[model samples]
Target: MENVEQEFLSVIREYERVIYKVCYLYTTPNATLNDLYQEVVLNIWKAFPKFRRECKISTWIYRIALNTCISFIRKEKNIPEIVTLTQEADRSEEDDETQAMLQQLYRMINRLGQLEKSIILLYLEEKSYEDISEITGLTVTNVATKLNRIKDKLKKMNKED
Candidate 1:
């Protein structure tokens, strides 16, 4: 039991940032990001014993994190919608411009459906189509199709801006 606990801690330490990134992307301001992070951690620990070595640990982590975030979102549908970005008011002009662009990108991402959110997050992380398909349970062709569609959607969204 102690060994299992230590192993779980080690895995969490290694993958905590990835988990946080998923939570950050999925959560609205009304939903506490930390709550989602904690829920993912709990789910990971609960599911750790059943984790077969059939896939990379990171892939497993992504699957668990995305599933937890999706579940939390579904349960919290009544929460008021809000998007919060970091406010670094003291930054230089160039930094402010970059921050604005990032905020806009995040807004567009927030508009995506849950599965599209997971796909784009993995894509942004530079995962191969095979990896994305495995994590998302989409076929390789489906992953490619969805990614192309997502790109077109983003393009149209940008054009409308």
Candidate 2:
């Protein structure tokens, strides 16, 4: 038990940022973000004992975090927008600008239907088509086609502004 606890702590220490980002991506408002973050951490702790290193630890962490976030988002009657970014190693002014764009993108994404929002979130994570397909249970071609359509939609929205 102690060993598992230690291992879990170590793994979390390495991946806490990913967990926090996913929660924030699934929630809006700081309070809801915090609540979801705690929930994700709790879920990870609960599921840690059963952890098997079948795939990359980060991938497993993402799967669990995304699923928990998705579930929480579904239960809410009025879901709020989520903003997320993959932290680049280089944190510069350009990165800051890109982050701002991501926030704006989230606002636009909020207007989309629930499934479209989910697909966009995964796409923004820069997941490969196969990864998105695997995570979303959608066919790779479907994921690609949907993403292409969503990009055009977003572009049209941007142009209208």
Candidate 3:
């Protein structure tokens, strides 16, 4: 039992950043980042024992995290939250521009529906369409189609600003 617990902890440690990115992107006022993070970790733990080696560990983790966050949103009946990245108040001019763009991208992403956000987030992480399909339970063709649409939607958002 202790060994199982330790092994699970190591999995969490290995995927900590990936888990947190999913939580951060899915965060809302109703479900704070920490709240979502806890939920994802808990879900991962519950599912860990039964995890078959049929899929990649990262895919399994993303599936759990995305589903947990999406279900939480549905139960809360709350809107998606815009995530702002924190940087030191004093920063270089180039850094400020880069930060602003990232914030804008996050803002646009926040405006997306839950599934859309999940697809786009996976896309940004450089997951192939097949990997995204696996994680999101969408077909590879569907993932590619949605990626194109999401890109166009984001472009429209930029134009609107």
Cα RMSD (angstroms) for every candidate in the order listed: 2.9, 3.6, 2.7
Clashes of each: 0, 0, 0
Q: Where in model 1 is the C-alpha error above 4 Å? A: 80-82, 87-94
Estimate the overall C-alpha local distance difference test score of candidate 2: 0.73
TM-score of each: 0.90, 0.77, 0.92
Of candidate 3, the 10-residue stretch with the lowest lDDT total is 85-94
Ranking by lDDT: 3, 1, 2
Alpha carbon lDDT of residue 84, candidate 1? 50
lDDT score for residue 107 of model 2: 63
Where does model 2 exceed 4 Å of error?
Answer: 29-31, 79-92, 95-100
What's the lDDT for all of these models?
0.87, 0.73, 0.87
Ranking by TM-score: 3, 1, 2
Better of 1 and 2 by TM-score: 1
Candidate 3 lDDT (Cα, 0 to 1): 0.87
**lDDT tens per residue, model 2, 35-111:** 88788888989988777777567767777787887788777747464444444323465667777776667667766
